[model samples]
Target: MTLPRMKLTDPKALRGYAHPLRMALLGLLRQQGPMTATRAAEQLGESVASCSFHLRQLAKYGLAERAPGADARERPWRATARATSWDDDSDDPQVRAATDELNAAQLALYTRQAEEFLARRIDEPTEWRAVTGFSDQSLYVTAEELAELTGRIDALLAEYDDRITDPSRRPDGFRRVSLIQLAVLSASPGGGPAPAASANPVEATPAAEPDAAR
Candidate 1:
């Protein structure tokens, strides 16, 4: 099978995967390979109708798309992009809303997953050791500046994407979560918006579901 290429659009894609369930749907495809709406709904504990609606939304944003030969029937859908990252670059209100909502949901998902990972590790007595690395900071930058920073950070993290898989790197139970808490670090101290001071962690991966045992 051909690896899916990134088909993320400027704003439409952002709006598409903003919902909690929609993001979960994308993960279903990425982590488990292509799947039909019915299967996704079952895994997600959602109704087939709801899952099908979410799948259509994903397609609208050019994120996950139906298989090449898929018809109107419930067919497998594959993710177009492996991962997505963005910052407050555009001034358009609609796009910004879409982007911000997507970001909020995305961060929440990852945050929850991180918590679960720690809880599980604490309960289990496994050879794999627990590890933690995190950062929080303040910065003064405009949307443009933040966008540039986000890009640089993404490139840096992508470098380590396959490091763990390579036998040369030496395997360990070690895990890392890199979170970029970028928002208004000053005036809007309540974590204002995306173009604020962002701390880019180097070891973050797509959020993991809490129940790995499943």
Candidate 2:
């Protein structure tokens, strides 16, 4: 099945999703699959009541829904979409605030995942150990080029998206890997947005000194 993606443009929806626990629950459903609140709570080390409430809240905002086989007493929930997206260019103050809240929650979760991986990395198989670690790099490119780069990256990641919602697709000895990708535009020396590369790129900026290269 194709990955479902919801682009949230409503401020009300953004506000509804501002809660950290709700974010976590939604992420769990998206990354895993249909799960009862009790089971999700157990996995998250949270109360079943809390998980149930949050799952309902997510449903209210169209972020999640009842699974096909779910019933009143044995209800199982699943994310309505594989991913939720919001544009940073929103003009509404409420939406901006809600976006900030969501971003902070996402960053916290990312940090936790990174720390957890590091803590247990030593015990992982040698093949995994050799491939896992933080990889940071920067490049100078035009805005259009950066957009293309991100699109290409998304296409590459889409190849593995099926594994998340389909356990059967998971290969032997393979585990879920969290790939946090960020394409941020670096600021110029003056601390503002960097200018696009000029036609004469060489003349746009002075060549770095040998000592400054490092």
Candidate 3:
């Protein structure tokens, strides 16, 4: 069987989803499961008025959609998809610009989040550790080869995106894992690091149980 090729559509699905608040709104809904705009606002620490505005914007981008509810006014929202992957394409100027803008903003946000998370983790009483590791090897390949490697890395990262929420696994220190992958262009100047942990990941019991429980 032949596999279907995937390419971003015109105007690009990402263009509509690139705004900061809209992106944050999606993250909020996904992490918290589903909730009304008012509830989302409370969790986000934003005013209900502002949260309602962003939730609508999220629907506009097709990143989120209203959930079933008794009243139209009580409509809740949920994230549309588990993941979206994109890469550089210069043949179309519009695609190139949109992709570039989205990628840059994402990188900046990730770096800031990761730094803040690590900084705070140092002070927390919990038994958790932060680590960074890398693999380096020389390969003789064309540009396409390198790009293919990146695609694989992204798929791997996506696999771990939603499974890192188990808190009970925390004490063991390995029950949960957050995968952060980054591929860069050397010719073009780059941004910084990956996004940090549990600004508000879903609640799960820590990995290790209490002594009393055992």
Per-candidate TM-score against the hidden true structure:
0.62, 0.78, 0.65
Q: lDDT of each prediction vs. the true structure?
A: 0.62, 0.69, 0.55
Off by over 4 Å in 2: 1-3, 68-72, 165-168, 187-214
Highest-scoring model, TM-score: 2
Question: On a 0 to 100 scale, what is the lDDT of residue 145 in model 3?
Answer: 95
User: Could you give candidate 1's per-residue lDDT for residues 1-214 as a string of tens digits?
Assistant: 3343453336766766667788778766766667888888888889999998988888887767878535676478877766655656678887788777777787777666656555655554433322232445556677799879977976886687664235356456544334434444456535555443324343233244311111
Model 3 bad stretches (over 4 Å): 1-8, 70-73, 124-127, 130-141, 151-177, 188-214
Show pairs that collide, candidate 3. Answer: 114-196, 167-204, 167-205, 167-206, 168-205, 168-206, 168-207, 169-206, 169-207, 170-207
TM-score, candidate number 1: 0.62
Q: For model 3, state the Cα shift of residue 73 in Å.
A: 5.6
Q: Alpha carbon lDDT of residue 42, candidate 2?
A: 89
* Model 2 poorest ten-residue lDDT run: 205-214
lDDT score, residue 22, model 2? 80
Residue-pair clash count for candidate 3: 10
- Residue 35 CA displacement from its true place in model 1, Å: 1.6
